[model samples]
Target chain A: MSLTILGCHSATPRTSAHPTSQYLEINNKRFLIDCGEGTQVQLRKYKIKFSNINHIFISHLHGDHFFGLIGLISTFGLLNRKNDLHIYAPTGLKEIIQLQLKTSNSWPQFDIIYHELKNDQSELIFDDNKVEVYTVPLTHRVYTNGFLFKEKIGERKLNINAIKENPEIEICDYQNLKNGKDFVTKNGTIIENKELTFDPNKPLSYAFCSDTVYKPEIATIIKNVDLLYHESTFLKDRQEIAATTKHSTAEEAGKIAKKANSKQLILGHFSSRYTNLDLFKQEAETVFDNVVLAKEGKIITVDNKTFATELTINQ
Target chain B: MSLTILGCHSATPRTSAHPTSQYLEINNKRFLIDCGEGTQVQLRKYKIKFSNINHIFISHLHGDHFFGLIGLISTFGLLNRKNDLHIYAPTGLKEIIQLQLKTSNSWPQFDIIYHELKNDQSELIFDDNKVEVYTVPLTHRVYTNGFLFKEKIGERKLNINAIKENPEIEICDYQNLKNGKDFVTKNGTIIENKELTFDPNKPLSYAFCSDTVYKPEIATIIKNVDLLYHESTFLKDRQEIAATTKHSTAEEAGKIAKKANSKQLILGHFSSRYTNLDLFKQEAETVFDNVVLAKEGKIITVDNKTFATELTINQ
Candidate 1:
C-alpha cells in the first residue's frame, strides 16, 4: 500500500502551501482523500493519471477540504469519462454538486454515487474481498471523519521444496495445500498442513486521522495500526490556540501515535502561521521516535512484511 | 482604466495556462471578472490585493468561469474581511454558494449582496458617479453576459494659464469654470467655455466580450470603445468547431473589433489544444491593425487621450 501527499496546509491555499488532500493506492484500488481547491492542478503537476481516481473521500464540507470536487468532476466530464464514480462524504455535499450541474445544464456521462455520512460512531463504510474501509469519527468544530484502509488476509503460500520431495503429492492436491489443508496419501498416510506450506505475508493496514483535537478515543479505536497519519496544526507552545480552534498540536499527534502503537507516524495539516516547522518535529519526537513530516509530492509505502514504512519523492 | 489578465484559457486549466478570469481597475474601482478555478492563486501571484476587490462578475455558471468564487469567498472570511462583497452573476449561483456555506456551517461575517442577472439585451448593471458598467448579451451554449466598463465623463480640466489671463474670473467661480460655464466680463465681453477649460479625457471605455460566438450585433453595442477583449478560442482552421461550440475564432474577434471601430483589440481564452499562439495574433491582425494576446499576468492599460493599449508584465 502507498500514500501520496498532495497538500498538507490548513485554512488557506497559497502558491507555496496548499490545503489538505492526499492520494492512496491500496489493494489495486485508487482513492482520493479530501480534494481541496486546486487539487486537479496538483494531480496534473504530480503526473497522476486523472482516470485512475474512481472514488473520492471528503472529510468535511469546509471549502479547504472539498472545494475542488466539483471542478474535478466537471473536468472528468469534459475528458469524456465513461466509468462510474463514487463519492463518500458528509451529508449536504450532494445538494451542492447537484445544484451546480443543474444550473450549468451539464451532467457527466458517467454514473455518480454519493454515500452520505451522518453517523457519529465508527462504522465500516466499504468492503470488498481484497480490502475494507472504515470511518474514524473525529472531534472537530464541524462533522468530520477519518478513513481506515485495511488489506484482507490472503491464501497461504506453497512450500515448493517440500512438495517436490513428496512425489506422491499430485498437482491436483496443490490447491488444498494452499488452503492450509493436510495432504492424504492413498495408503492413509497423512502429512501435516504446516509441513506442506508456509504462512502468507501478514495483512497490512493504514489509518488516516486528521482535522480533530486531541481525542484519545481515536487512538484506542486505531490501536496497533501499521501506519498513522495525524493532524499536527501547531506546536506545543500553541496548545491553547489548538484547543480553541479544535485542532491538534504536534505533541498531541505524537501522543496519539504512541498510544496507537503505530509503527510509523506522519504529521501533516500544518497551520499557515507557523513558518518554522522544525519545532513541530522537535515536539512530536518527544513522545514518538519514528515521525515524518507529510510534505507535498512525497510518497510513503507500507511493505507486506512487518509493515515497514518507506518514503520516496515523486519525480 | 487598466486590465490585468490573471487567466485566459478555455476549458480545463493547466500548469502553463489558466482558465478564464481577469481583473479590471476602472475609475478607482476594483472589479474581478470571470473567476475561474485557481483565480485566487492567480490574484496572489499577480500581487493584486484581494481585499481591494469589492465586485465580482461571473459570465456564466460553467466551471471554468466561476469555480473559484466559493474558495475566494471562504478565504475572505478566513482573512477576516469586514467590507461588503457584491457578486453579479446568474440567478442559480446564490443557491450554490449559500448551500456550500450552510453545509460547512461557516458564514461570512461580512455582507454578501448578490445581483442576479437574467437580461438578454444590453442593460446597465452598475452605475456610480465615476463609472457605469453595462452587460453585453452574447450567444453561447450557456447564459453568458459580457461587461462594458465606461469611465464617466469627468469635470472639464481647468486651464490655469487661461484662468490667470482672465482678470474677471473670480476665485469663487472656479467650480463653475471647471464645470465648463462661460464667463462674462464686467465689460459685457462673452468668453467661450472652451477658452476656460479642456475636455476631460474623452471618457475612456473598455469592453470585455468572451465565451461567446461570432455575432455581429455585439459590434453595435460596443461601438467606438477604447479597448475590446474578445474570446479567440480557435483559429480560422477550426471555425466550424467554433461555430458548433458557440465560440469565436481569432479572425472573428478581429472582424468584431474592426466593425466596432475599437482602437485596440485583445484576444484571449485560447483552447488548450493549441500550444503555439502565433497564429491567433496573425489571424487577428488581418482585420484589425492593433491587436494583442491576453497572456496571463500581462497587464493591459487603456490610456486616456489616444485610447492606445499598453502591455506590460506583472512583477
Candidate 2:
C-alpha cells in the first residue's frame, strides 16, 4: 500500500501549507482521507486522477477535515461523473452536503452513498476479498474515528519447482495446490503443500490515527501494524494546550506508536505555529525510533515484510 | 476604492486558477465578495489583512461562489477574532453554517450577523455615512444578487490656497468651512463657502455583477458606475451554452457594461475550458472600449474622476 500526503498542517490552510488530507492507493482502490479545504487543488497539484477517487473517508466534522467535500462533489457533477461515490464519515456530513445541494438547486449525476459512522468502538466498516477497513474510535473534542486498512491474506502461491517434480500433477490440479491442498501422486506418493509453495507476502496493514488525544487503548487495537500515522499537533512543551484541546503532542504520538509496536510511525497534523517540522520527528524519536514527519506531497510505501526503503526515517 | 481579484475563473477551482472571490476596499472598510473554495489561501497569497474584513457578500448558494465561507469563518474562530462578522447572502446560508458548526460542536467567538436576502428587486443592504451597498437582483438558476457599492459624498475639501486668501478666517471656522458653511467675518462680510473650499473628490462607486444570465434590467440598477465587474463565462461561440447555464458570454457582459455607461468594465469568471483569456477581452472590447480582463491578483483602483492609470486597459 502507498500513502500520499496531500496536506498535514493543523487548524487552517495557509498559502503554502494545507490542512489534513491524504490519498491511499492499495489493492487497486483509491481512497481519499480527511479532505480539508483546497483538497481538490492539492489533488490536481499531485496529479491524482479525480475520477479515480471512489471512496472518501472523513475522520471528524472539523472544517479542517471535511470542508472541501461539497466542492469536490460539485466538481464531480460538473465533470458529469457517473460512478457512485461512497463517503464514510460522521452522520452530519450528509445533511451538510444535501443542504448545500438543495440551496444550489443542483444535484450530482452520480450517486453518493453515505456510510455514516456512529459507533465509538472498533468496527469493520469495509471488507473485500483483498482488504478490510476498520474504524478506530478516538477521543477528541467531538466525535471522531481513525481508520485501519489491512490487506487480507491472498491465495497461496504456486510452487513451480515442486509441481515440476510431480509428473502426475495436471494443470487442473494447480488450482487446488495453490489453495493449500497437498497433491497425491498416481503411484500413492504424497507431496506436502508447504514444500510446494512459499508463503504469500505477509498481509500488509496501515493505520491512520489523527485528530485525537493520547489514548493508549488505541494502540492495543492497532498493535503490530506495518505503518501507523498519528497526529502530533504540538510538542511536549505545549502538552497542556494539547490536553486542553484534545490533541496529541509529538511525544504522546511517539508513545502510542512505541506501545503499539508498529513497524513505522508517521507524525503529521503539526500546528501552524511551528515552521520547522524536524522538531516533531526529534520529539517523536525520543520514544519511538522509526518516526517520519508527514510532509505535504510526500509518498510512503508500506510492504508486508518491512517499510519501503524509499520512505525510511531520515535519521 | 480598490478592488482586488482573488479568483475569477468560473465553475470549479483548478490547480492554477481559482473560482470567484474578490476583495474590495472602500471608504476604509474591507469587504469580501463571493468567496470560492480556495479564497482563504488567495487572501494569504495577496497579503490582504484577514481581520480587516468585517462584511462578506455572497451572490448565491453555488459551490464555486461560497464554499470557502465556512472555512474562513472557522479560521476566524481559530484566530480568536472578537469583531462581529456580517454576512449578506441568501436565506439558506445561515442554516448550512449553523449545521456544520453544530456538528463540530464549535461556535465562533465572534458574532455572525446574517442578512438574509429573499427579495427579487434592488434593495439597500448596507448603509453608513461613508458608503452604501445595494443589491442588484439578477436572473439566475438560483437566487442571486449583484452588489452595487457607492461612496457617499464626503465633506467639501478646504482649498488651502483659497482659504489663505481670507486672513480673518479663524481655526474654529475651519470645520464650518469644510462642512460647506459660509463664514461671516467680524466686519459682517460674508466669505462664501464655495470660494474657500473645493468639493471633495467626487464620490466613487463600483458594481459587481456575476453568475447571472444576459439580463439588461440589471444595467438599469447599476447604471453609470465608476467600475463594473461582470461575469463573462463564455466566448461568443459558446453563447448558447452560456444562455442555457444562466451565465453571460463576453459579448453579453460587454453589452451590459455599454448599456450601463460604466466608466470602466472588468470582465471575469472565464470558463476553465478555455485557457487563452485574450479571446474574452477581444470579444468584450468589440462592444465596450474600456474593458480589462479580470486577472487574479490584479488590483484596480477606482476614483470619482476615472479609473486609475495603473489599471489602464490595453487597446
Candidate 3:
C-alpha cells in the first residue's frame, strides 16, 4: 500500500501551504481523499494519473476538505472521462455538487454514483473482492467521517519443498494445499495441512482519522491498525483551543494512537498559527514514542513487514 | 486603471498554466474578475490584499471562469471579513453558492448581495459615483457576459496659475470653477470656462471580453476604449475550431480591436496546445498595431496619459 499526502494544512489554503487532500493506492485500487482547493494542480505536480482514480472519499463538507471536488469533476468532463466514478461523502454533498453542475450547465461525461453517508456509527461503506472500506464517524462541528481501508486475507502459501517430496501431491492437488486442507493418501495415510502449506502474508490495514476532537472511542474500532493517520491541529500548549474548535492536539492524537496500538502513526492537518512545527513532535512524543509529521508531497509505503516514508520536493 | 492577470489560460488548469481570473483596480475600486480554481493562492502570490476586494464579477458558469468562487468566499469567512460582498453573476449562480454554503452548515459573517444577471443585451449592471460597469453580452456555449469598467468623468482640473491670478475669486467658488463654470468677477469681467480650467482626463475605460466567438458588435460598445482584453483561445490556423467552440482566434481578436479603435489590445486565454505564445502576438499584430500578450502575474497599468505593462515572476 502507498499513500501520498497532497496537502495537510488546516483552515485556508495559502501561497505555499494547501489544505487536506491525499492519494491512496491499496491492493491496486486507487482512491482520492478530501480534495481541498488546488488539489488538481497538486495531482498534476505529483504526476499522478487522473484516470487511475475510480473512487473518492470525502471526510466532510468543510471548504478546506472538499472545495476542489466540483472542479475535479468538471475537469473529468473536459478530459472526456467515460468510466463510472463513485463518491463516498456526507449526505448533504450531493445537493452541493448537483447545484454547481446545474448552474454551469455542464455535467460529467461519465456517471457519478454518490454514496452519501449519514449514519453516526462506524459502518462498512465500500467492499470489493480485494479490499473493504469502513467509515470512522468523527466528532466535529458538523457531521464528518474518516475512512479505514483493509486488504482482505488471501489463500495460504504452498510449501514447495514439502509438496515436491510427496509425489502423490499432484499439480491438481495444489489448490487443496493452498486452501489449508490436509492431504490423504490412497492407503488412508493423512498428512497435516500445516505441513503442506505455509501461512500467507498478513493483510494490511490503514485508518484515516481527522477533523475530530479527543475521542478515545475511535481507538477501539481502529485497534491494531497497521497504520494510523490522525489530525494534530495544535500542540499540547493549545489544548484549550483544540477542544473549543473540536480539533485534536498532538498529545490527544498521540493518546489515541497509543491506545489503538497502531504499528505506525502519522501526524497531519497542522494549524496555520505556528510557524514552528518542531513542537508538535515534542508534545506527541511525550505520550507516544513513534510519531512522524505529514508534509505535502510526502509518500508513505507499507507492507506486511515494513513501513517507511520518503519526502519528495514538488515546488 | 490597472489590471493584474492572475490566470489566463483556456480549459483545465495545469501544473503551470491556470484558467481565467484577473484583478482589476480601476478608479481605486478593487474587483476580482472570473475566479478560476486556485485563484485565492494566485491572489496571495501576487500580494493582492483580500480585504480590498469587495466585488467579484463572474463571466459565466464555466468552471474555468468561476470554479474558485466558493473557496474564496469560504476563505473570506475564515479571515473574519466584516465587509459586505457583492457578486455579479448569472441567474443560476446564487442557487449554486447558497447550496454549497448550506451543505457546509456555515454562512458568511457579512452580508453577500448577489446580482443575478439574465440580460441578453448590453446593460448597466453596476454604477457608483466613481465608476460604471456595463455587461457586454457575448455568444458562447452558455450564457456569458463581458464587463466594461468606465471611470466616471470627474470635475475639470483647475489651472493653478489661472486661479491664482483671480485674487477676488473666493475658495468657495473653486468648486464652481472645477465644475467648468465661467469665472465671473465682481466688476462683471468674464473668463471662458476653458481658460479657467482644463478638461478632466478622458474617463479611462477598459472592456474585458472573454470566452466568446468572433463578434464585431463588441466594437460598437467599447469604441475608443483605452484598453481591451479579448479572448484569443486559438491562432488563425485553428479558426475553424475557434468558430466551432465559440472562441475567438488571435487574428479575430485583433480585428475586433482594430474595429473598436482601442488604444491597446491584450490577448489572453491561450490554448494549452501551443507552447510558443509569441505566435499569438504575431497573429494579433497583423491587424492591430499595438498588442500585448497577457501572462500570469503580468500587471498592466493604464492611465489617461499612457498604458504600460510590467511582468512580475510569481513562480
The interface root-mean-square deviation of each model, in the order shown, is 0.7, 0.7, 1.0
Classified by CAPRI criteria, candidate 3 counts as high
Tell me the whole-model lDDT of each prediction, alpha carbons only.
Answer: 0.91, 0.90, 0.89
Best by lDDT: 1
C-alpha TM-scores of all predictions = 0.97, 0.97, 0.97
* Model 2: residue B302 alpha-carbon error in angstroms: 2.3
Decide which is better by DockQ, 1 or 3: 3
Chain B TM-score, one value per candidate, order as shown? 0.96, 0.97, 0.96
The best-first sequence of candidates by DockQ reads 2, 3, 1
Q: Give the winner by DockQ.
A: 2
Q: Alpha-carbon interface RMSD of model 3?
A: 1.0
lDDT of 1 by residue, B124-215 (tens): 99999988999999989999999999989999988989999998888998889778889999998989889989888788888999889999
Model 3 ranges with Cα > 4 A deviation: A185-188, A307-315, B307-315
Backbone collision count in every prediction? 0, 0, 0
Give model 2's docking category. high
lDDT of 1 by residue, A77-149 (tens): 9999999899999989998999999899889999999999999999998888888889999989999999898
User: Which window of ten consecutive residues has the lowest lDDT sum in model 1 chain A?
Assistant: A306-315
Segments of candidate 1 deviating more than 4 angstroms: A168-175, B168-172, B186-189
lDDT for model 3 comes to 0.89
